[model samples]
Target: MLILAATPIGQAADASRRLAEVLASADVVAAEDTRRLKRLAAELGVEVGGRIVSYFEGNEERRTPELAAMLVEGQTVVLVTDAGMPSVSDPGYRLVVAAIEADVAVTAIPGPSAVLTALAVSGLPVDRFCFEGFLPRKSGERMRALTELVAERRTMVFFESPHRTEVSLRAMAEVLGEDRSAAVCRELTKTYEEVARGGLGELVEWAAGQEQGVRGEVTIVVGGAPSDSRTYAPEDLRELVAARQSDGLSRKDAIEQVAGETGTRRKDVYDAAHS
Candidate 1:
């Protein structure tokens, strides 16, 4: 059997009872960070009795087969990441696939999740949503990626690095509309936990004005685009394209983003820009 347990994203007390029990008795424990796992076990007051093995992104490919072999040998294997559940923007998906292919029964211990936690507190409509893990790091790539979701009607969740939070918000404001609603959740469930809620423009300014700068693990929740497609005047599309250009997107990419968001033809946007 393969067990995927959820560890606390911040507060150690958030660890589930089943997680503690499993940690203490699994036949093989695969952890993204063995050191962190040991510390977490000590904090939970549960001495791990299983053979602990490192299983992280760097070694997941190599370690998966070994862990799966243990499962094939009838041993109970538990997979855990440094925080949250295994395999969520983490290093457990490969192992899960291996387990299933080996016909090992798989299950999970429900616990804290930064994705859902941020969404629930984001004050956005949670009726329908999507998790977008992390945005591309480069400005051009990031702009192109956000451009694809400009018409997305489902609330979007994203994990971002603290250093890039301000720039990301600025890019979002430029492409997704400055008035788009969003929330920046930082150090969730931790000592400095904070949730800054406002429009994308406001968030960009807030992140910029931070004297110490945005710090800690960050999750961004942006409200979905309005369901009804609104028509945009040629001039409006031109201004949108200019905004993206000022934010570092090339003229071509900017036109593409504006056309995509406004449902305008690329040629029309180009004429609007130069006309």
Candidate 2:
């Protein structure tokens, strides 16, 4: 059997009862960070009666097969990460896949998660939302990814490193528009947990001007585009009008073309053209 356990994101007491029992009795415990695992075990007052092994990003490829083998041999393998549920932008995905392939029964001991913690506190509408785990570290790649999400209608959540928080928010401001509403959740469920909410532009400025760099994990939530009026600029409308005109469209046809292409009023495009 393979057990994927979720530890608390912050408060030690948030540890689930099953998590404590699993930690205490598994035949083998695989942790992303052994030190943190030890600390968690200590917090729960559970003495691990299992062989502890490292199963982080560096060793996942190699360790996964070995761990799966243990499960095949009928050893209960417990997998844990630094925070949240395993296999969610964490290190247990490969091992879980291997276990499933080898016909080993797998289950989870669910606990706290930063993604849900941040979303719950975020002031944005959460009736519908999507999780975009992490953006590409490189600025160009990150911006490109954000561009594709401009028309996304569901609130989006993302996890980011503290050091790159400001940069990532700024890129989002550029692609999603400065006025797009968002929240930046820091150290969620922890003592220093902070939720900063505002337009993307404001958050970018605040993050950039902070004298002391941010610390700990960050989850960012950006509100979706408005259900009506897709926020197309006059310049964008004009560009569409010109493109259609070049495609042999008459002035009336071009106006309709631009309106249909951009979901803007034909009169708005005409005013933009003459102004």
Candidate 3:
């Protein structure tokens, strides 16, 4: 059997009872960080009865099959990352796939997750939402990704490093609109946890005001565009068209491309541009 366990995103107290039980007795334990796993076990005061080995991004490729082979031999192989559920912008996905292909039974011990925790506190509509993991680090690539999501009506969640949270918020303000609602959650469930909720512009200002750079694990939740609102502002459309034009497209072609990209009719975009 293959068991995927969720570790604490913040407080060790958040670790599930089931996770502790599995940790205490699994035949083999593959951890993202062996040292962290040991620390967590010590906190639980339970000696892990399993064969402990590292299973992080750097070693998963080689280690996944090793663990999968254990499963094939009928050993209970428990997979865990440093925090949260496995395969959640974390490692463990590749092993899961390997298990499925090998006809191995796979299950999970669900517990604390930063994505849902952030979304629930974001003050945004949660009926519909999507997890976008992490955004590109480069300014241009990040902007392009934001532009692609400009029309998405589902609340979007992204994992960000503390240092890049402000930059992400600023880019969101430009592409998604300054007035768009958003929340930045830091070190959730931890002693110094913080959540800032407001419009993108306001959040950007708040991030800038952080005496020290934003710290800890960061999760950003941005409200979706209104269903009836134009996906792109007039300025956004114009800039997009201008970009296309600079790339050798005629004005008409640029408008057409921009309209298609924004899900607006070419006639409507043409009228908006000329208005």
Candidate 4:
């Protein structure tokens, strides 16, 4: 049997009752971070009677079969990450696949997740939303990715590193429009947690003023393009492209993003920009 448990994102009290019981008496426990798992066990005041193993991204592929074998032999396996539920942009997915293929029963001990935590607090409409785990690191790749979402109707959520929060926000502002609404959620569910909401451009300046770089975990939630954006004309797209170009995006990227948002063909926007 395989049980995926969600750990408290930051608040220990958030740990579910089923999670504590499974942690106290599983045959084996696999965690993304062994040290964090130990700390969680200590905080919960539960004795982990089972063997503990490291099952993070680096070794999950190699260790999946070994863990699966244990499950095949009727051992109950508890999978956890440093925070949140297993396989929610975490590394427990491979092990889950292995368990399923080996004819083992798999279940979850659901608990806290930063994704839903951020979404719930964000002022943006949450009725429809999508999670984009992480954007590409390079500026160009990041811009390209944001451009693709310029016209997405559903509110979007993204995970970004503290060091690059400013960069990512700036890219989003340029591609999505400076007036686009967004929220920067930092250190969710923990002490000093914050949710900064405003126009994307305002958030960029806010991120820039962070003297010590945005600290702790970050989740960015940006409201989607307006419904009327799809009816924009070529002249309107040219003006939009010029705005992003003024914001330091390359001319090519500006055209690409403008075209995406306005539903205009790239070549059409290109011709409009030249004219």
Candidate 5:
């Protein structure tokens, strides 16, 4: 059997009793960070009895099969990440696939999740929602990504690094509109946890005011486009492309952004822009 466990996103007290028991008794424990796993065990007042191995992004591809093999050998292998459930935005998806392929029974100990935490406190409608793991780091890629969500009517959740929060907010504002409602959740479930709710434009300003950049783990929640949102005309598409181009995107990327934003064919957007 393969157990995928969830670690506390912030406060150590949130670790479940089942998590403690599994950590102490699993035949093998694969953690995203061995050191953090040790610390967590210490906090639980339980000593892990299993062989501990590292299973993180840097080595997940190489380590997944090894963990799966242990499961095949009739060992109870437990997989865990530094925070949240394994295989979320964290490392564990590959191992899950490996376990399934190997006919290993896989299960999870549900616990804290930053995506759900942020959404709950976002003050936005959550009846329909989607989680967009993380925005692209590059400006053009990020803009294109946001443009694709411009017409998404479900509330959107995104994970972003602290340093890139401001830049991401600005890009979101440009592509999704400045007045779009959003919330920036930081250090969730921690001592300094904060959730800043406002328009995209307002969030951008708040992030900019942070002298050391937004700190700690961050999650972004943005309200969806209105159900009755207006459709874009060819001229409007061309204008949007021009705006993105002026913001330093290449002509090709700008066209892609406008096409995604308006759900127009890329060729049509190109023709409209050039016409």
Candidate 6:
């Protein structure tokens, strides 16, 4: 059997009783960070009687098969990460997949997750939400990813490095609109936990002004665009077309502008204006 366990995100007392019990008696423990695992075990007063093995990003490939073999032998194999749940932007996904393929019983010890923690406190509408783990570090790739999500109607959640928070917010403002509502959660479940809520453009400005810089884990939540209103008047479309036309724009440019501003088809705008 393979047990993917969840560790505390920040507060030690948040560790569940079942997690401690399994850690104490499992036949083998696969940890992302052995040092942190040992500390957690000590804090919980659970003496790990089983062997502990390191299974992080680098060794996950090699360790998955070995761990699956142990599970096939009917030994209880427990997998844990440094924080939050296993396989959540962390190790244990590969092992779980391998265990499933090998016909081994695989389960999870659900516990603390930064994604949910921040989302819950964000004050933004969370009835419908999507988790976008982390944006690509490269500026171009990150912009491309955000462009695809521009029409996402559900509130979006994302994890970001403190150093890049400003840059990410700037890109989000550009793609998702400057006035879009968003929240930035920092150091969640800890004493210094903070949640900053404002427009994406406001956050970009705030981040730029911060000389001290941000620290600890961060989760950003942006509210979805409103879905109720869709009507546009003919007068509004005419005004848009006339403004673009007055800017020395071509007939094609005026029609395109009217279409984009009024959410009407370009052909309809062209036909209406020509007629």
Q: Which model scores highest in TM-score? A: 5
Q: Write the per-residue lDDT of candidate 4 for residues 1-275, one digit (tens) a residue.
A: 89999999889989988888999999999989889988888988988999999998889889999999999999999999988989988988888888888889999987898989999999899999999989999877887898889878899999999999999999999889899999999999899999999999999999999989899999999998788734666678778889989989889988887777776778998998988
Off by over 4 Å in 4: 229-259, 264-275
Per-model lDDT: 0.93, 0.87, 0.89, 0.90, 0.91, 0.87
lDDT of 3 by residue, 33-110 (tens): 999999999998879997999999898799888988889999999988988999999988999999999999999999
- lDDT comparison, 4 vs 5, better candidate: 5
Clashes of 4: 0
Any idea how many clashes model 5 has? 0
Q: What is the overall TM-score of model 1 with all chains considered together?
A: 0.87
Best by lDDT: 1
Q: In model 3, what is the error at residue 184, expressed in angstroms?
A: 0.3
Clashes of each: 0, 0, 0, 0, 0, 0
Residues 165-250, candidate 6: write the lDDT tens digits: 99999999987889999999998999998888899999888888877886788899999766635655656666667787897767
lDDT assessment of candidate 1? 0.93
| Cα lDDT for residue 217, candidate 1 | 94
User: For candidate 2, lDDT tens digit of each residue in 1-275?
Assistant: 99999998889899999999999999999999999999999989999999999999998999888998999999999999999999999998888889999999999988898878888899888899999999999876785577567667799999999999999998888768889999999888899988899999999988987789867889999998777767778887777777877878676667655554455666898887655
Give candidate 3's error at residue 51 in angstroms: 0.6
The list of candidate 6 runs beyond 4 A from truth reads: 228-275
RMSD of 4: 3.5
Better of 1 and 6 by lDDT: 1
**Per-residue C-alpha lDDT of model 5 across residues 223-265, encoded as one tens digit per residue:** 9987754667778888989998998988988888777777667
